[model samples]
Target: MAEKTGNAFDLNLFKRLLKFTRPYKLVFYFVAIAAILLSGLAVVRPLILQNIIDRAIIPKEEELLLYFVSLMLVALVAEVIFQFLFVYFANWLGQHVIRDIRIKLFNHMVGFKKQYFDKSAVGRLVTRAVSDIETIASIFSEGLFMIISDLLKMIVILGYMFYQSWRLTLFVLLVLPLILYATRVFQKKMKAAFEEVRTQVSNLNSFVQERITGMKIVQLFTREEKEYTNFKQINEKHKKGWIRTVWYNSIFFPIAEMSSSITIGLIVWFGGLQAAQGGVITLGIVVAFIELSQMLFRPLRQIADKFNTLQMGMVAANRVFAILDTKSAIQNNGTIKLEQVEGNIQFNNVRFSYIEAEEVLKGVTMNVNAGETIAIVGATGAGKSTIVNLLSRFYEINSGSILIDGTDIKDIELKSLRSHIALVLQDVFLFADTILNNITLGDPSISEEDVKQAAKEIGIHDFIMSLPNNYLYNVKERGAMLSSGQRQLISFLRAYVTNPGVLILDEATSSVDSYSEQLIQQATEKITEGRTSIVIAHRLATIRNADKIIVMDAGQIVEQGNHQELLQIEGGYYRNLYEVQFVSGIE
Candidate 1:
């Protein structure tokens, strides 16, 4: 969330945004030059009109009329060309700036710690990357350059009006102060409204995205009407936010129109009186003043609107910069590199907490030698999954140390540390891509032949070959096209292909069918071969053959032994857990 700056134009934010445009300054300079030319050309038409009326037509000089008309036509053609360049290059620069920003924003998000994502909404982040950035582009395309051009035109027109007749020019500007005051008020109110609208858009997007992704759960729980009611509440907020902006627009534009009419009326009355007195004002002067008044006030009216665009863009930039400014707590300061690790692991008095003052891992220490299979059995929320997260350094631990082959895991580069370890979680997530791509993860070094060989080694090659397109079969979104069992097999093949020095299976087969369980068990045997492995499971049968079993209770290790060796204890936590699971057939 971004804090409100309350100013109509945030100068600091604007300067920061201007930094992204530096790479395309050549195009932007061309746009600025075009706007300058267009502003100068805009006043030529009215000057030519005044000359035609007073000098050429009234004096009956046909040749002078033809000459002035030709010049006017030439000015019009040049104005049109400049206008085209202004629009084209302005938009071109805007698109390129947004492209660079979107990439930077995405790359920043990719490096954010997992804890940041745990609290942030996915759809909100997407909105920032997509819609909010689009609004920023409009600041260039329809806001900044246009406002500058309009301001320049107004200044030139005002200068021309004064040169023609200072008395009439003063009359036309009599109502200007009132319009300026009203515009100031409108800008402040509209800035707040646009900010509210952007916030509601993010909220609406988040709610809709969450509901759609979890639609199956909603339907299973018969929450259709309930969810709809919630959606309507959020949608209503979104509507009200825009309506507020619309209301401000409605009030301000009418005030501007009435003010313009009053100025024109003043010009007519004063000019008419001056003419009646002693030919002090001409008909040509009055006509040209009318045109000049419109040209002057129209951009003033539109400046208010374009300022709205500028403010919205500033608001969006503030939000995006807030994200970019967020520093991830998980710093990767290690420089140590290893071609291969021996797979010995240790947790020395490790302690952790997802939230402050409520520890999840409490001074639990463990060790595993090379090529040893360790099973961790614990009740739900006993910090089983937290161990895997800490091991991978997805979240920083509060105290104590985790070591791999006598090297502090923190002392090793994150990429080097994780590359030697593989994790196969309980819920397998596959991208909307081919089976081969999911298995190889687009790693060109791991070719099709490598994937097939690994899958065959894990006993899933036959199952994949039976599919419609075999290795090329598309998994669709989140692997929706495949069964949970089939997705699990793919995950197994994915892990096997990596051939990591250490493997961690966090309830990998706990939710699969009996047949899938049998296949996964076989895959597990091949994957854990000659590697250090940690299996976290609720089913006691899965870890029956583990070299050592560590029983956990309330975030602390209570028992450690092989399965049979621990099951023989009369009332040990492991034995009781085994009996309960065996009797309930949860194994």
Candidate 2:
């Protein structure tokens, strides 16, 4: 959640949110006109009731009474129709506006650099895009224009009340300052309370999302009771935040309600007394004043509740706009799109960091010749994966340059640069979708036959065919239905179908069984043939046959040569690393 300073009702944020209504200006006007019509029509029935009491009922004129009754019925029906229009159009406008904002927000989020996502919680972003956006929609549906309508109705009724009898209206006015004072206090308190509630909602959402996604870890460690206790605390805090807002509403509305009821009592006592004492005030005026008093005070009471809606909307808008205003997007300024890239890649003394405090890649330099297979062997934080991520433009390099085919990657169009590369990560993610769709990812350019051919070339076709639905089998969420090695193979097939010029396997064979390793090794050789490949691995045996092997440690390349040449160096980094892995069978 984004923190906004100053007023809780942010006028500037409200204006920015309303800018989405530009495309639907006509609908906006229609909703506004309906509100105006509603406000004016609200006074119609009271005026008719006054006429019936004074002109017909007082003189025992039954026909005249029926006439005024019919007139009142007409006014009621008109009020109903316009009220329907006001609500329906207001909601319709809100839906369309949120549709645009949601699309824009999702598009902006997708373009952000990987580091931004690395630091932010997925649950909070989901809240911004989904539920928080829904909160802002209420601004249009029930906040701004509706508040305007209610205030307008109160003004018209108050004006009528004064015209009828200023003496009686003065009593109503006497109690208004108290209503206004309580409403102001309530609005301010609720504003802060709602912000707290929203923050807690985001906290709850994040906790639930992470725990559910990592349920296997919790159950594996047998920490269910501990996590349950944590959730209970968070949920209880959320309840307390909401109850504070409820407590304010409980205090304020009754104060408002009591003031209105007292005003009505005063009008009855004062107006009835004057009518009996032979003053200008009549029974008809008293009746009209009673109806008019509710019309005046009810909206004054609701204005506070409407301010709650407005305050919530401002908070939601602040958070959403914060996402929209992020400068974390990759600066994709390159216009050069290469139809065929030669796959030669170079990193020239690159220095990069996801955060300022720690540099993940420190002045590292390397080269991969076109059609050469290079292996990077290093410890966990050796910057092996960082090299590939920078090459893929997933994160921007802080210093130095990366070039593809002798051209600076920053000058190569991002789509074009990425189109020439295929990456199969260690932790393969598959959507809950059919195997074929996962491979093609719904790309129309890649036909089903093309997928099958690529799968067969990688030698995983027979394994896939053995399944019940073959290529059509649903892999379930994160490929949960598939074994670890099986998911890796699917990722390979997906990368292969793209037919990229460069291939990257980031520890692709480290976590699989021996049989799957052999299968993956075969697939690797098939895909890397005549293509530039950067293989990151902890298993030293897998990359022994590469054209070159680069040894990295602590974010720097310490050694590089062919495997036999590096092994020939006395107690070299590669030799030492190979010895440890060979002896222990794990890195």
Candidate 3:
């Protein structure tokens, strides 16, 4: 594993962020044009005010003053119209960019190697997808618009002020050095606070999600009081995070406001003195300088704050991009399609290890003829399930080759390999949907007749029919409405309907009751006929009739033969397991 790096808000991150909006460049161009035109009105209206004071109002020319005032009104209206267009387009671009980012993140996550998911928590990934993305979206919309408009307004106003009277402009800008220094200090502190807030939000979201998903466990243990205490602690952390952010923000505005007040006061006092001494400062000049003074500090303040927003956004982008950068350890080889398969499988010197130093399968070789039923029994963590995962290409083998019909499984396309195989996992996962949907998952195009036949074959059709809505009855999330046996039966039907050439049953019968297990055993015997099957079980009696049984211990096969052959060795683990069950029955 690579060491984690904490370069969350680096310059390169901004470059990557720009790439997301590259597709919508035209929208950005339109927004920029509208912003410039709107900001130009800011400079123009102030000059119009100067004209009224110097040429019309001071000379007692009401008619001329009214004329210039009307022009100012027209400029203001135009500015409002352009402002509306700018806002609409900026928001549209922001939302579309966010949509693209989410789609990219989702596609990347699903394609990630199983190892990434094994190491990452579900709640953390969920928060990255939702809360983190939303934070970046806010920066895209509000932050971008404010920064651009403010920058343009400040630039144009400063140029106008300088052209009118440099002396007055200098007076207003006297506080510039202090403001810059203060802004830098505040922005750094604010960014740190914002980062803390972002982390706390994710933690709170993750806690809530875990509580809801594990509500049953909580209720079973009656830990509602404990859970509430945990929630309160997490919530308090979030509260403190926000309070720190507010503390930083609250102190910023007052300093900027004070500077603006001092600037305004200085301009009025100094400019008045200059005008009294028959200097170039006029009432109109003073008014324009004061107006432009406000324009200068507003954008300056925004520029400071925008940097903080960009910092938060960069942290979010780092997480999102980190997911996007992950490469899947297992990837499709060539496009190998099995239009027709004989179900023959061969494992040649197969070796696998989940971790580097620990070997799970060590140079084991086996070959199964087409349509053969093979059972693999082993102690827990003996790599029985690992072999099945390899067959499905869920995890790549460390060193070995798995062949289907004499062709290496890696040579075959992953989609084709998986499509030809069906897996009935021990833990049945049903969606929050109707029973029909769950059964039809294996083959959505299956006909009603086929569905009914598959269901009846698993001996579940009658039970399903007894329900209030039969197939349409909702299963609830995770199939909570049904017993464990019913869920297993439904899973069996799903696999049976697929009619796959290769079938893997990994503890598929463990959850079913004895009666249901008998029915399942019978149904599965018929289903595995003329099809390759790999059965894994802990129960000693479940795989007794298997064509071959391979017993494993400590990642190597210790026994391989028929059930009677294994039983002949009375002291072996399999024999011991069977005898223990036999003795328990006598009691």
Candidate 4:
């Protein structure tokens, strides 16, 4: 929930991130060892060059010169070997750590309560799962280990400079103030810039994802220009955030480069003057100091950039951990496992709401024996859908209990409870996959033959056969290849294949044509036989044959009876509803 991490370096968040490396500790240790070895090797090259210049080139001893040259070659080869190990293992450790974190994050998200998803953006979640996690990987590869290696190199270089000549080392120290001040200011500013950039990236993703998903609404309403303008504004904000970091980099690097150059120039000037005046300074010392100054300054420059990477990883970790810390999952404390669930259901004074102080289902009570079909009918917002939602335990009731058979639903395990129930909604969602896969939903027990048999039983086999590849035909996303009525049929067949003990259809036949309606009617009759079924319908005529019709108004059951038995009551709710639907012929 924090807008940003604590500072450029948040040790707490960094430690939390490093926890992912516990599973790969061997790789972590190897990368650490390689960093130390590379630091040792780094000092060798500069020292060899200094020895070669003063001992071999200046003294004119052929055999000593050859001996020093060969030693320099060996040092160069060793440096290459350790450098390769350091880079490769650091990256390898990063990738493994991120893989473990990504999987754990996704698994945690899957268990969150449905209300959490209802209030959150899918695109924002995608950013956390995909791009933000990718950023955290750099904490290992380029941020942590890389920065450690560079700092070790700088330490060795500074130590060497002091040993060679304390005077030249003091000259190098003069430029440190300017460079250090610039680095401090740069890190603070760049950390803020990267935070802004991450926020804007998440916004950009959310805007694009929503607009693309609802493209039909935009074009149908002829608001494409308005949406395009909105997108441009979001994209511009994202660009500005990134450009601010670029602006900081452009200013900081030049100052660092200038400081480095000034230090080298000062080294040569001071060393040569002292050497001319019969001091300890020599030509080899001057040359070696020049090389050592770059060696120290280059890593200092890289550490700033790597620290920027580390800061970004921290920001991303803070955001990702916010979601992972949410405790909105439904409490599943039931230890009772249902080997079989009878279809009896009862709601005893159930009260609930999606939002606080705005009750949707108010003190409702209902009961149904096993193997009965009940139809619920009401105007919109009459808690028709809420009843079924509670029965399935999708939302916990504010007060009272829902019982499946005789046991409280909260006492039954969730998987075992849901396995006996199948829900078909008016809005059917199908993945972009084959018709067979959509029906079976890749359930290992439901084979292709099972799907075909289910389709035949539901009487939609011929319709599926009319498609290009029959059951193998691709339905595209959300079943876009199928008409609304055809999608309803697929949903019915999907429910049928499950062989659930209780089937609840919510407004399933309200939007279909007469021909599809007839097919659905036949399928419903076949599927609901000998199973407890609850049908919520807007078209009052469809449920005339229900064993019991429960009339609900606002949030309570107003009437309950057989269709004709309720129709006999004078000026009753169901009586008026039935007349209104048949007289107007529209719902």
Off by over 4 Å in 3: 1-9, 276-278, 442-444, 447-449
The sequence of per-residue lDDT tens digits that candidate 3 reaches over residues 25-54 is 998788888878877888887798888998
**lDDT tens digits, residue span 1-587, model 4:** 43455478987777788888888888899999999888878878778788888888888878888888899899888888888888888888888888888898898898777778889999999999999999998998899998999989888888888998998999999998888889889999999999999999999999999999899999999999999999999999999999999999999999999999999889888998987787888888888889888988888899999999988988888989888888877778877877766689898999999999889998988888898999999889999998988888777889998888889989888878888899999999999999898988888999888888888888999999999999999999889999999999999999999899889999999899999999999999989988999999988777889999999999988999999999998999999987887876655
Which pairs of residues clash in candidate 1, taking residues 3 or more apart in a chain or in different chains? Answer: none
> Which candidate do you rate higher for TM-score, 2 or 3?
2
Instruction: List, residue by residue over 1-587, the lDDT tens digit for candidate 2.
Output: 24586575776777788899999999999998888888899888888998898899989999999999999989988899998889998989988988899999999999999989999999999999999999888888998889999988988888888888899989989998999889888888988899899999999999999999999999999989999999999999999999999999889888888988898899889999999998999888998888888888788778889889988988888989999999888899999998987788888999998878689888988888999999999889889999999999999988999999899999988888898899999999999999999999988999999999999899999999998799999999999999999999999999999989999999999889888888899999999998899999988888999999999998899999999999999989999888888876655
lDDT of each: 0.91, 0.90, 0.82, 0.89
Question: Which run of 10 residues does model 2 get worst, by summed lDDT?
Answer: 1-10
Give TM-scores for every candidate, taking all chains together and pairing residue i with residue i. Answer: 0.97, 0.98, 0.93, 0.97
TM-score of 3: 0.93
Pairs that clash in candidate 2:
none
- Give a tens-digit lDDT track for model 1, residues 1-587: 34559999987788888999999889989999888888888789999888988889989999999999999999888888889889989989888988898899988888777899999999999999999998889889988999999999989998988899999989888888989999999999999999999999999999999999899999999999999999999999999999999999999999999999999899889887876675768877888899889999999998999999988888888888888788875788889986897899999999999899999999989999999999999999999999989999999999999999999999999889989989999899999999999988977789999999888888989999999999999999999999999999998888889889999999998889999998999999999999999999988888999999998888899899998899888889998887787877755
Model 3, residue 232: C-alpha shift (Å): 3.1
RMSD of each: 1.6, 1.4, 2.6, 1.6
Show model 4 residue runs off by greater than 4 Å: 1-3
Displacement of residue 4 (Cα, Å) in model 3 is 9.2
Tell me how candidate 4 scores on lDDT.
Answer: 0.89
